[model samples]
Target: MNNSLKTIAFISGIVILAYGVYTLFKPETQISIGDVDLIETQDNTNSYITIAVGIVIVALSSIIGKK
Candidate 1:
């Protein structure tokens, strides 16, 4: 049903949004040696895109079946 689809979309959007936010703050890679530590910084481009997509999905779900 349309309602079920909307519910699924809403949940998926929240999940995606959470994932995007998590990745945005999460470190990409890390390495540790005897006296040296290295960390790779994350590129926010993907996270931003994911967040945008999630927002769009959530918005669409809210408008589904509306006149």
Candidate 2:
């Protein structure tokens, strides 16, 4: 049970980290109309939240695995 939990934590961390990176790195969508440029960007809050969650999960997994 302990090992399984650790594995889950590690996997979840990696997935979340990837999502965070994608969210942070994705380019804004831009639309140009008659010399007007409109750009839509991702919310910075969600990326930070995922990054924090990912780090926490990875840390917990390592601590658990060491036991």
Candidate 3:
């Protein structure tokens, strides 16, 4: 990994983490796709996933570029 990559990862991680927290607290949304309607909701499983991914990205930014 390089400094640029680490920077990108760090920024991306922050964005993902922020969005994850935001969505976790926000209400669900209803959407229709090709006549199939779906209601989106956040659960613990998803919360964990986003949090994990974000943490992994941030950790990678710290660990990957240097010793």
Candidate 4:
């Protein structure tokens, strides 16, 4: 049971990390009019937070697994 839980955490962490990276690089808003492109960029605070959370979770899971 514990191993299964750890596996789930690891998978979820990877997914969250991937999602954070995707959001960090992807544009939030884009508009193209007559060959003119307008992109609305936002701060990456959320992405950073998500990435941090994922890293922490992964680290915790691995650390616990070693015990």
Ranking by TM-score: 2, 1, 4, 3
Candidates 1 and 4 compared: the better one by lDDT is: 1
> Please, what is the whole-model Cα lDDT of each candidate in the order they appear?
0.92, 0.90, 0.83, 0.89
Candidate 1 at residue 26, lDDT? 82
Give the per-residue lDDT digits (tens) of candidate 3, residues 43-66: 767876897899888998899777
lDDT of 1: 0.92
Which digits, one per residue and each the tens of the lDDT, describe model 4 over residues 1-67? 8898899999999999999998899867989999999988789999999999999888887876675
Q: Which segments of model 4 are wrong by more than 4 Å?
A: 32-38
lDDT of 2: 0.90
Cα TM-score per model: 0.82, 0.86, 0.68, 0.80
Error of 1 at 65 (Å): 2.4
lDDT of 4: 0.89
lDDT of 2 by residue, 1-67 (tens): 9899999989999999889989998888899999999988667899999999999999989999674
Q: Which model scores highest in lDDT? A: 1
Q: After superposition, how far is residue 52 of candidate 3 from its true place, in Å?
A: 1.2
Give the worst 10-residue stretch by lDDT in candidate 3: 40-49
- After the best TM-score superposition of candidate 3, give how far the Cα of residue 51 lies from its true spot, in angstroms: 1.3
C-alpha RMSD (angstroms) for model 2 = 1.4
Order candidates by lDDT, high to low: 1, 2, 4, 3
Output the TM-score of candidate 2. Answer: 0.86
List the candidate 1 regions with Cα displacement exceeding 4 Å: 32-37
